[model samples]
Target: MTRTDIASRTIAAPVARVWAALVDPVALTVWLPPEGMSGRFDRYDASPGGSYRLVLTYADASAAPGKTTADSDVVEARFVDVVPGDRVVQAVDFVSDDPAQAGTMTMTWQVTAVEPGTRVVFRADDVPPGISAADHADGMNSSLAQLAAYLEA
Candidate 1:
């Protein structure tokens, strides 16, 4: 089997709460980023064949119209499996015009209850050739940290 891009985090909240943050669109926007990032859900039906779009926003004084800032990128995804509060499998796609620049990767989030907290494991497969795996790893870690902080708040 091919190795996947994986990241895991332990959240100091119950499995149900952490799971809510992962699957609930309203809750997801609360902690999608460490910086000025937020997501909006369009058709967030969490089930096989269900599609959703997450719009990420950032403040960019220097950016031109229809351009993303250095701090934000919007990722639209469709769920492959909706495992309630335990696991969620989805295919994440970065919205872009170029086919070579555009591709889809599968993201799986697993939540396990571990005493006064929940362990969330995230795995992304089929990373495009041009993307940096390490960069994604760093970003994912930061995002999870942000999620944990939001949960605590």
Candidate 2:
């Protein structure tokens, strides 16, 4: 059975700033990659029915090989819904030959105004079995932390 992973963090920024970062492709490349990984975007179109391609490279691929290549994990994602300053929902698929990692995962990033900050909630549904629960949680948390830092700094 497929799984779902959810992570949340409060960012020390207004919802507008956080939302801008969430929708901007360049901002994503800066803070979306988890710890120990860096990412690049081949193409990006942020809107309903639009899509983007992201390639994430590991710092040390020898330790944790990638699904798309020896050192990279490529992703093709479509924006299902984009609500400014509110939420973004996407359908994400990994570019990999391995069946275990094959499938469209629904990703939702939701934001709500909080005292002196914004609460960002990230949810991944229908996660492929190839991704471990522990790793997914860590990655999501890492991304959230990075987002906070990018906006706060």
Candidate 3:
């Protein structure tokens, strides 16, 4: 099996609160986008087998062209599973003309109740070749940091 990209953070909040941020579309939109970007979901459903289309826009696209357009990248994803406070699994694909970026990436987020808070572990399986490892890692870490702040605030 190909090794997955992993990022984790221990948030200063309970499992239930942290879980809420993961499944709530409103909360997700606030925190899911990495630094230097913002996002909006065209449609979102958190239930098992539900699907969503999210468009993430860079603050300054001239620096980094998006996969779907000059300024925005679309993410088409389906919820593979939602285990409430435990885990949320999704199959994700980028809407991009670039063949190197075309593939279903399995994103698994697992949560564990820790001493001071909830430990959120994010794993990205089958990451598309077009995305560099460093870039993906930074994105994951950025999102995790945002998640922590969103919950602790």
TM-score per model over all chains: 0.81, 0.98, 0.97
How do the residues 2-120 of candidate 3 rate in per-residue lDDT, one tens digit apiece? 44899999999999999999999999999999998999999999899999999999999998889999999999999999998899999999999999899999999999999999999
Better of 1 and 2 by TM-score: 2
In order, how many clashes per candidate?
0, 0, 0
Q: How would you encode candidate 1's per-residue C-alpha lDDT over 18-84 as one tens digit per residue?
A: 8888877777777764354455766677768888877676555244121233444567788888888
- Tens digit per residue, CA lDDT, model 2, 16-123: 999999999889999999989999999999989999999999999998899999999999999999999999999999999999999999999999999989999999
Off by over 4 Å in 3: 1-3
Model 1 segments more than 4 A misplaced: 1-3, 34-36, 61-72
Q: lDDT score of model 3?
A: 0.94
Cα shift from native, residue 59, model 1 (Å): 2.9
Model 1 residue 138 CA deviation in Å: 2.0
